[model samples]
Target chain A: MDIVVCIKQVPDTSEVSIDPETNTLVREGVPSIINPYDENAIEVGLQLKEEHGGTVTALSMGPPQAEEALRQALAMGCDEAILISDRAFAGSDTLATSYVLAEAIRKVDSYDLIICGKQAFDGDTAQVGPGIAEQLGIPQATYAVDVKVDENRIAVKRLLAGSFETIEMKLPALITADKHMNVPRHAGLRGVMAARKKEIPTWTLEDIEADPEKCGLSGSPTTVVEIFPPQRSHKTERLEGEAQQVARQLVEKLREAQLL
Target chain B: MNIYIDAEKCTGCQLCVKACPYSAIQMAEGLATITEACTLCGGCVSVCPVDAIIWEAPAVEEVDTSDYQGVWVIGEVGEDGLAGVTWELLGKGRELAEDLNTELSLVVLGDEAGELAQKAAQSGPDRVFYAEDPALACYRTGTYTDVISGLINKHKPEIVLFGATEQGRDLAPRIAVRIKTGLTADCTGLEIDPEERLLVQTRPAFGGNIMARIITRNHRPQMATVRPRVMQRLQSQPEHGAEIVEVPVSFNETSIMTRIIDIAHDEAAGQVNLQDAEIIVSGGRGLKKPENFAIIRELADALGAVVGASRPTVDDGWIAPYHQVGQTGSTVQPRLYIACGISGAVQHLAGMSGADCIVAINSDPAAPIFEVAHYGIVGDVFEVVPALTEIVREELGSG
Candidate 1:
């Protein structure tokens, strides 16, 4: 099995904060890390490779800085890394991103399986994986927590809002990894050194033979017309007292407000 | 499509760099440069005081949309008949359709599609299109996409709406790609652009830190998956009649690439649908230990509320991921939400902030959760949760 795990570098949204004064996101000093789910996807790929005996390749589409994320994937035991970056790819939505990625996966060719994070933390669309599968004309199982390969088929245990469903699909399919898939392992020193020395090629839109029209904002159907801070209520009624007293007061307030 | 900086108007204030959510703009040689990281969100365009950052939007090929009419909502069927989200979508779909002076239609696909569609017609859609087959019952991506996309291609609805549930998120994008159209995800707001007759979609990005209003320009059947619980469901009216259309599902079963092996519905794990719950009591890392979640459970029991968990708690194995309330987990809009020990991260807030009333209890007085909670108690969860449970048990006579 040749596994290709798609990854993305995202700003640590947990550390991101808004400036109360300017009402804008304080992006300064915020660190960018490999999306959490992508890390799990890489782990799934590596584990599958170990069990089934195949090479694992980590792929990402972002600026040059995103190569750092791919290197981390390699350090975590990926056999190879590839970065698909191009200026024309800027302003791409999930659809365009999937198109470019699907094209790149086609170029990778002869792959048995493709894995992607359930969704990027920042975008949280959860569309790219399925979109890529559709563009590739393959089957996909999203929010997969466990996957087991058997010969030419794989069974995926997927998570839903209130249930877990196991879906079986043929090879050369796509599966989006959920956070519960597996605990990701940290990169070892030897692996890090080897990854640093390894050559990871960067592919552009032209290299993937993607239609320029479907590569970026041009291919994107949705456009952001406005951006603003989410409105938040500042007024909070504090119940200042002992725990017992506060609890009583809360109950009383709830009763008075007809919320109890 | 051209994005360039006007050298004459550039003052290199670097505001765009700070304003950019993606950090796509940078100062190089005292002039701001747009990097490949830019998603063309046009965030920097507005922050530039000199208007030096110019974004020439790409020309969209003209599509004759006059042939496309009616607003169609993809109704979902869950373990319980028609999902509440279907009614919610119909409620909002009615408004949009009314605004556009078009008909509102509901498309349901399942083994009981006819029954579900009939049940949904009470919500007052002008039309209901249903495709029935056992193969369409369990929501295989291939069959669902084929059937819906086939219907969409045939009917040419001007706009399509879907609930941003797991099934919707999985099926909408595939259908959109198959039909060669754009589909926005998890929109919190949807409205019709009166002049252009476009769907204006507003959704949170960057984990609810910012809101982006999006539009599918020049695309027919402007499609978007709306967040559940955000839209209100209209009262069912028996007097309302709908034109029912039966769709024939045609697809090769052998051509389907996936099969459902088993569906294990863990009642203990996700028995309580957080989105549908009226009250939710959520625990966080501040609960101190995994075992301490019992206190939250007790409180939820006393109040007849569902138990929810913050991401940290779920990630720490203190609770199941199904109990998680946050951006990456579930976006819920219950009537009352009680947060215990949760520090109120933006991710968590993105989910339950829509609750009608919020009560937060934390030992730390400065926790961000207090900022959004309508009622705040600066006390330990161990102390406050049990006390509140006792008081509520007595007050509500639920003990």
Candidate 2:
């Protein structure tokens, strides 16, 4: 019943400033935090560990500063934390990202279930969880709203298009959890103190035995040729007059626009 | 170039085969196998129900245009003839055209849309190739793709851009497959690399966790669908007139498969689509109960804004899926986004972070929603939401 929760430290999107000149996100002073979704994954892992009597390991791949995210996971009651930081991993797309993460998981070995947030807030692709499952050739249940672990199988309520589908998969499976899965617990003073002295393992590409070509931008099948902010036009037609009149005029305007 | 198929997960659904339109997928040994004729249009990936199919193109090194050429955008016409997104894409197409140093053109279709050609001209396109047949009035994917593909084969634009609306979503993939070209969807950003003459399509991936840059280096008329409001609309300058070229559409009834039963226009179709709503007030599980959303409804009503909710609230039957905003739900870009009692988890933020201004009201100061809010009010939303609604009502009245 050993569980591994994968987390990422993302730029605090709120504090992210867009450079108007370059139309790119300015990450200079923006603080990074554990991707909010990963917090739930960690909470789920810790709860499962408490109930099942197994160790929970927190894993992340980012720069050196990403150790903070792993440490935060430890403070939240995770038994162990691992950080896989390497400069070469930068600029990897979802395909390459999943490759590296899957390789990292293989290196960990003997994990029963791997949990990740449904998607990261920054990328919005919702591809990594499934992509990782694909790379590992494991059963993946995505957009999982609820989980019920039994003797040898895990029953999950998966979110599909406009409906819920209950699915059952064997152990050593991957599940991407949604926010509705559970509310994450806060780190108390005792856990915080314990986390400070916990041994946080650091792994690199060589340590993980990953193919350098398949683990980063080189392995990535996609490349972003450009990154720029969207341009907005301010041509709002304010409908005036009485409420009913305005509504009528608005409908008429839509008709005129052939939008109705 | 390596196409990976999870056969264990593949249901052999034939959706990819049917969606291919090009018959690129065939049943081989009772499994769906992609042949060399497979155009890599990604039409199959979108239609796969079990999410079993994944096709990855070769790693992008440089733009290779050994096969085809030309830059074309499908000139989408609203009933009245002008679509704001069509204009925005022209601005984008203009940029891509200049980068490739090629002629920028648009394929205009529909009845009496030729008059709209005047508006398309202002976007600085080199030409407006149109089909004014009465049969092309309403958007039929089969017909539109046939007409557009016919024009593409004739002119051969190296790049093609479509507004990722309902019409474009249906039409673009079909045309891409017909032409054996590549198509990217919901692109938030687009750019041309001057050196290689490549159209780099940038979009959020992994539910907004990372941005994936995609390109159709080998495919001719590298196609991408730009989301509406994700790009700036160009001003209509009548002075920048385009060369009006009339392209004849000869798609007979035999080629058309799906017929339009009826064109029931949605009441909210033409107005600010919810995804494009500038001001959104969202409710979530922390709101305590469903009834409390009336406060949210009133606030949204007063502000003339749209209301959204987290998956929990929607799952609890408190709101419809349309009102749910997140990674699994709708993406929004409102001017002002106010989250009431939401904990601000990553999934919820993925949908609303694009807003210009964010205001969060939650009792927990440590709530993740507060971290992203430009303005934070730490208090019970029951009291705070009502008070804020009243204040806005009074302020707007006075103003």
Candidate 3:
């Protein structure tokens, strides 16, 4: 029942803002938290640990500041936390990312299950979970809403088009959990106190024996050719009137625009 | 890789023919012959008693794949038929096809693709391909990808586009993995670079703080999934049609790992149908609390529009996840969009900026939402919302 949860520190997507003049993210003041989905992944791991009596270890890759996110996982009942961070891991796409994360999981070797959030809020790419699964050569179910574990098999209810499908796969498979699978438990004060005493380990690409060729932007297959602001037309026509009249004006405007 | 039949030892039980998911095997004179439609999925090789069928998984590097030309859209057929995104892709695909000076093909994979494919051919594609069967009637990642990727491998299309729906998001990455190609997800803009003949995929990054323009360097048939409603559909010309190529389907049950045990749709909850809505009235954090969502819904009903929520509102549990409109939720490009109490974050605006007209109602004079809005009203929601609702109720009642 040993489990590994992959977590990430992401900027609060809600607070993230673009600087209109520079056309860049105003990253300085925005708070970073554990990715919302990854928090659910941690919850799934802790719940599994509570039910099956196994340790839940959190794994993440980011700069040193990301250890704060790992500490948050520690506060939520993870037994151990590992952070893989170095300048080499910067600018990695999903392909290179899953490679590094999979290598970290392989180093942990004793795990029987791996869980991840369906997607990162910032990146919004749901590929990394399945990508890690494919890299590890195991069956995977993505967008899982509910899961039940048996000795050798696990049944998952995965969300799909207009419906959810239940799937069964052998143990040692990966699942990318969708939100609302369960309401994550709040970390108790006791857990928070214990987290300060826990030692969080840091791993480097060399420690994981990762191919330098495959660890970063250099090893990545896809590249971001350019980044720019999407063109927007802010030419707003103002219509102000009394409250009751405003709605009528709106309807009339819709008619005038041939949109009614 | 090649798939062929050794008809010499073949017993014409038609087992191999029945097992071929792509209907690539045909019985000729009591012996099975592999057709050009074979996707080399090895669906038939296991079923052959006489060892008559053989398939080799292609070494992606060995295949020239250069012969693959044309921009193809994977037609997503809904329960009834013809999802709007198909026509939208057709509209965009037409331009890409013209730029490449190649043909445009669309593959319709569904439970009943014949009708769907015919419907698609009328959209003015050069060729319309269909692979349909009861196994593929609803989308199983295994079944749909088996049939669709098979067609892609056989045809080597230069570029492929998919609607970033639930099915498309689920299926696209798997196909990209299987076919050994790169996929760009949630692309808002697509264009063919005539110089090198690359598909330029533009999508937001860091919650729309920046938009990344991406291109797959070596992959043949660059794949991308665009959110539905982001592009305009081509005008339907029932009088026009294209060449329809029907690919036969015979799927084996064992190859599929998952089954539809039960279907639980949120439709009973009557969530907002933002994906197809012509108009969307969305609320942001400025609505103040979950109970205030009723105001947004009231306005939506007045205009026969759907209720949409910015990511913050949905994150606050003010509305169901389905009502969310942003990078994390559904991207909607309606005919008209109205925002209330929304500050217009880059991510929030990215989703609905494609609307023909945008109206923003926020008290903050400098709210970013004002930038993209075609109309603006700086006022208090408490006053403005109730007034708008009464007006809508009276106006619609009179109409």
Best by lDDT: 1
On residues B103-144, what C-alpha lDDT tens digit does candidate 1 reach at each position? 999999988888988777765899999999988878999998
Segments of candidate 1 deviating more than 4 angstroms? A256-258, B272-275
Q: For model 1, what is the alpha-carbon lDDT of residue A147? A: 94
lDDT of 2 by residue, A147-181 (tens): 77888678777543234556567777788887657
Candidate 1 local Cα displacement, residue A144, angstroms: 0.5
Q: Single out the weakest 10-residue window by summed lDDT for candidate 1 chain B.
A: B266-275
Fnat for model 2? 0.10
> lDDT by residue for model 1 over A59-84, one digit each (tens)?
99988999999999999999989999
Runs of candidate 3 exceeding 4 Å displacement: A20-23, A86-88, A110-112, A159-165, A203-215, B1-67, B236-241, B246-250, B284-294, B310-330, B343-354
Alpha-carbon shift of residue B23 in model 1 (angstroms): 1.9
- lDDT of each residue in B186-289, candidate 2, tens digit only: 78888876777677788764345345567766557777778777677755566777899887666575434433333333343323246757678889887888
> Candidate 1: what lDDT?
0.89
Instruction: State which candidate, 2 or 3, has the greater TM-score.
Output: 3
Candidate 1 all-Cα RMSD: 1.8
